[model samples]
Target: MASRGLKFVNIQEHSDARGNMRIVEVDGGLPFVPVRSFIISDVPTGKTRAGHAVSCDELLIVAQGSCLITARTAAGLEEHRLTPATGAVHLGPGTWLMLSEFEPGTILVTYASERYAETRFFEDYVEMDR
Candidate 1:
């Protein structure tokens, strides 16, 4: 999920006596395009999710709260502890991603180039080739 180009971005939060707002950039890089955007919320503690890959690439942003994403690839291993203020991470095709230790109200915002496909692999390190 967040095993690839997951880099931190700095964003300004607009907050007043009423509430706060966060703005995210939806732009993308070459070989990856934005086909859709969505959010995930209401995650429970000590639970893991996002055990899939894509033929296309994706960008994952922590819309709210914090969580850890571990991506294991033949290329190597990447782990991210993300907060809402954090930037986005790009997960490329053939990469395996796992989400765990989700703090309360952790919202995941994602941009994808392709619709969901089932041929992508689930996270399994030993069974894969780099």
Candidate 2:
């Protein structure tokens, strides 16, 4: 499994007698400087989200619980299970992403390189292929 434009980044966790914390910054584990950020949570079971591709890059982090992420690119399809310890997945432009099989109370945080724009979204996979 080569993930083409997608990259898995390992997050560094700092632990002490108090607790643990993971920091994300540009040029660190985060590949891009995010201009937008969003959170997805409280999803009902047996449901999916994000069946589209964007022109700008994105990074997804599983803040709590777990979920399955499926992405399609020019190379092929790639699947990944996202968990707190699993770090984050960096999605390049034009990569189709679908998130599903989320555990109860799963919280996913996403960072985007660009602001939201309807014109930058490709809802159909066929359109992305072109």
Candidate 3:
């Protein structure tokens, strides 16, 4: 189920020529808000995470390493192949995201507008749409 077709997810990039280091930040001030900030890592190769979406909006970045993030919406599913030193990926409500194709040591940093609530739709994509 690819939903219908995702609108399109952005994969930001940050670079530093000094030591050849790039930093990605999801700073405040956007159409959405941020209530919590966290990172997800230690995922096995080819394993997928991101079983849920935010009721408001979400900002994500690849803190370290790299992986693939797919945004699934009622419109369709859009794939964003992320890399280290990139900017944040913004996701909105009623969106199902799957983080897969990890390159080992892949880390995902996320910013949300809500607290960590298990009651939120982590899976079961049906209700997420409704």
Candidate 4:
């Protein structure tokens, strides 16, 4: 399901005795070429992160463990539970995101379409000029 510009993508996974592996590529599971990437982990239970919006597109993948992601936009509010098997979620520019309910050892990897810039982030959705 999709809300506003947010999309839930199911990436193809290959499994074997070695373990499981999933690949993301431009125009594939990932919609754009990423200029930056980051990993988030060690979040305490009941804590939240990212209560704001950005001017760049991003893809969030729960590489290990799980977490709950809530996104808000002009359209409405949507929630998703992300696990390794759940693939990834795409967040477009100006979409507000709040992540919480993190299980221990949860590792979230994010790919961004733009370079990191503090001015590109907005705490208030209404402040976005878009």
Candidate 5:
């Protein structure tokens, strides 16, 4: 399944008569302070995004709808179905991640420990596995 470097974190949710909210913080919820963040949405059906690995850590949240995430690990390939109810997944270095099967209007929110740097990214899964 998933590499030990990848972990799932259930973000704390606060709900009320108004709505629901989740809290993400350094040393409290998130293990590290995110210097960069991004959102993935509007992914077309049958399209898949793969071959991305970074040197730092990553935290992914299913903000809306659902999607499937697959990561390569030493043990084998591990797959996870992510929905707003499942919370987030924290992936450390050396893990290859692929995202697909996104429902319409699905939103994926990502937080990274470091800012963007071409040198910090490895497009090859083999390079990341090392």
Candidate 6:
């Protein structure tokens, strides 16, 4: 929830006889403009991906399939199930994330406020709780 500064963005979908569409923009609800973007797809069953804490915020969107994202921070830990309907989950700085229990053909898209920089990321979860 917003209490932890974590937000679940609800995307408005427009559907008709033709197809369905959803529009997301910087000014819509995102706190910051994304400078870098990436996608995770075809994750094997029982596999997991862990990410370190970074200086910038992140927006994770489950474009396809489904997965559970657990994020830990100084405040505590929060888990979110992202789907196409739920849209995206926003994590602020100093948050460590772990992705697991991915369904077949699951596709996760991530957006970052800052450009990719290895030096800006830390894998030490303990340090992030400081």
TM-score of each: 0.71, 0.87, 0.69, 0.87, 0.87, 0.84
Q: Go through the candidates in order and give each one's C-alpha lDDT.
A: 0.68, 0.83, 0.64, 0.82, 0.81, 0.76
- Residue-level lDDT of model 6, residues 2-108, one tens digit each, is 22346777666789999878766898887789999999998888988866665677888888889988777656777877788788888887777778989888988
Off by over 4 Å in 2: 1-4, 127-130
Off by over 4 Å in 5: 1-4, 126-130
Candidate 4 residue lDDT tens string, 3-75: 2568887777889999988888787757888989999999987898887875778899999999998877667
Better of 1 and 3 by TM-score: 1
Ranking by lDDT: 2, 4, 5, 6, 1, 3
A best-first ranking of the candidates according to their TM-score comes to: 2, 4, 5, 6, 1, 3
Q: How many residue-pair clashes does candidate 3 contain?
A: 8
Residue pairs in collision within model 1 = 1-97, 6-89, 9-87, 74-130
lDDT of 4 at 80: 82
Residue runs of model 1 more than 4 Å from their true location after superposition: 1-21, 25-31, 117-130
Q: Model 1, 11-121: lDDT tens per residue? A: 556889998886655452323557677787887877788765555676777878888988765467778798876666777766677788889888888777777663355
What is candidate 3's CA lDDT for residue 118?
Answer: 29
Top of the candidates by lDDT: 2
Of 3 and 4, the candidate ahead on lDDT is: 4
> What is the overall TM-score of model 4 with all chains considered together?
0.87
- Residues 1-130 of candidate 5: C-alpha lDDT, one tens digit per residue: 2244778897989999999998888878787889999998999998987567646788999989999998876556778999999989998876778898999999999998877773265675563332
Instruction: Per model, state how many residue pairs clash.
Output: 4, 0, 8, 0, 0, 0
Residue 109, model 2, lDDT:
94
RMSD of each: 4.3, 3.9, 5.0, 4.4, 3.7, 3.8
For model 5, state the Cα shift of residue 21 in Å: 0.5
Residue 31 in model 5: lDDT:
74
TM-score of 1: 0.71
